[model samples]
Target: MNFRELHQDGCFLLPNAWDVGSARVLEAAGFPALATTSAGIAFSLGRADHDYGGGRVDRDTMIQRIGEIVAGVGVPVSADLEDGYADVAATISMAVEAGVAGGNIEDFTGDRARPLYDLSEATDRMVAAKEAAGGSPFFLVGRTDVLLVGGTLDEAVRRANAYLAAGADCAFVPGAADAATIGTLVRELDGPLNVVMGLTGGDLSLDDLRKLGVRRVTVGGSIARALYRHLVDAARELAEHGTFTYADDQIPQSDLNALFDPKTH
Candidate 1:
């Protein structure tokens, strides 16, 4: 199915990949689509995720990385454009130019003192994004960090509905992991619902979320963080214990090569 159709009915898992290699590996694993995680990309570039303190990777760099992933994969790829890189119009245009089929524009302002955009300003940004997409077949996901920034569920629903009315194809509430909140949003919102998985108190199963009427499920940066955790553990073991046991569960070279081989793919 096309990327847009993925949000029409049943829920599907949209895993975030940090680079072309990871994107290719995920596509080989049979996921229908992929997303570029801002955190993952930042970590790969030797920086912290959402580098609010400054020194974040620039927008052009992100667009280039996203384009590489699109070129490397056969399935649709969406991007996690952190605050639309601070310019809604340019970010949307660059994403489309980079061959992205979908992308999210969040309301987080990257300011610790004032974390989120006001509801009206946020809705206007979404409108600008939708207009920038023009006649292209782009799925513009309107995301609100309200809950993530400690706002109430009611406010989240309010902002989500506003964004949808402004022309968002989907509304993403990152911190609404519990079944009740997810269900409420699904019932109240007019468009497809996108939820991030593995939140502290909101770890519902895929079947559970689907039953709750969720349309899209993404892991955000959890997969990248988990993989990095394993990497750290393995490195610590080898460095501190002088053991090679970390290689025990590694994928064989042949299998990895087969996945990357163009003809095989």
Candidate 2:
């Protein structure tokens, strides 16, 4: 099914992948669709996430990596293009050219003094992205970082609704995790709502979110963080104790070879 159809009725889990290998693994696990995680990609590249100024993972590298992930998986992939790297429409056009079925454009400015763009400007950006998409079957997700950056729920709702009106297939509010907040957002949002799970304080399960009427659930960078934590622990064990106990339950090399083989996998 297409990305937009996944959000039509029931809720679906959109796991984030940082590279071709990760994307293939997630696709093998049977998810109908996948998404790119900016944080995960940055950390894998030895940088920081959400580099709105192109200081960390520059726009070109990010686009190239996104293309790689899309090429690696058969399932539909969504690009998490953070703030469109300051050129919203152009970045989205690049993402479309990269073959992403859909992508997110957030309202975060990356400046502490003014963390989010003004509602008017943000709506304009959404319109530009929609127009850039043209007749392509691209799903445009409008994301608001207001609540994630300490803004009020009312303001978040306002910005999200405005973006939806301007031309967004879905509204993504990342910070609302609790049952009460999520329920309120579901009730208040005029369109499909996407909530990111697995962050700190996000204990709700898929069933919990589905019961709350959420249309989409994503686990932004949590999977990547967990994997890195395991790597760090294994390194410490090998360095401090001179042991290799972390190799337990590792995926067999032959199995991975088969999984990656073009003719068989």
Candidate 3:
């Protein structure tokens, strides 16, 4: 099935799963699809990475990792492909062949909080990515960082619509996506809506997001960060005070084992 169709089926949450274990748990919990969070993967690798900004991975690495997630769960995976991780058309061409059901290409730089390209250049990049994909009809999501870079929702909506016009199958406005803003974008733009869930927290439930016209919702790195925070706090508490408060609130061991059972796959 094509990504547009996957997006059109009402509100679907693509909970970000860091590794095989997390992916398996999400699959067992019955998520319709799971997308990889770049932040989560970076942390797993012990690499100082932020999506594609910190360091670019070889095509083999991306393919192997993405394919692993796709194989681990019987569901679609939309990779968090940061700007296709390259500036050249040839590099982006290779990225489109990575076997993800879809991906989001955000115009973010490593240290800068703003888009790396001018509006026109960003549009051209998205167009190039679409052509490189060879009409397999994958979701070429164009993400606007207006909110992230201290810009307005109206600006984000405009950028999103422009991205849609430039051939993105869906437009994603990460950071500070509110119901009113999301609803406004839905009414203003005429394609699929992809919003990031769980910044501080998802202000709306999946059903609520759908009502605001969001088709796809992703939780970004919150899952990985939450897990990290627990681990760090637990370690600190034990190192200093001898306690396991974080461990007490953890998921049961049986559930974890059950989710990763070989037979499940």
Q: What do the candidate models score in CA lDDT, each in turn? A: 0.91, 0.91, 0.76
TM-score of 2: 0.96
**lDDT, model 3, position 109:** 54
lDDT score, candidate 2? 0.91
- At residue 24, candidate 1 shows an lDDT of 90
Which stretches of model 3 miss by more than 4 angstroms? 1-3, 51-60, 87-97
Candidate 1 error regions (>4 Å): none
lDDT of 3 by residue, 13-124 (tens): 8898877788888887887778898778878877645534546555457656776787787877788776665653554455456556777777665556455567888888
TM, every model: 0.96, 0.96, 0.88
Q: Give the candidate order by descending TM-score.
A: 1, 2, 3
Q: Of the pair 1 and 3, which is ahead by TM-score?
A: 1
* Candidate 1 overall lDDT versus native: 0.91
Give the lDDT of residue 40 in candidate 2.
96
RMSD of each: 1.3, 1.4, 2.5
Q: After superposition, how far is residue 222 of candidate 3 from its true place, in Å?
A: 0.8
lDDT: the better of candidates 1 and 3: 1
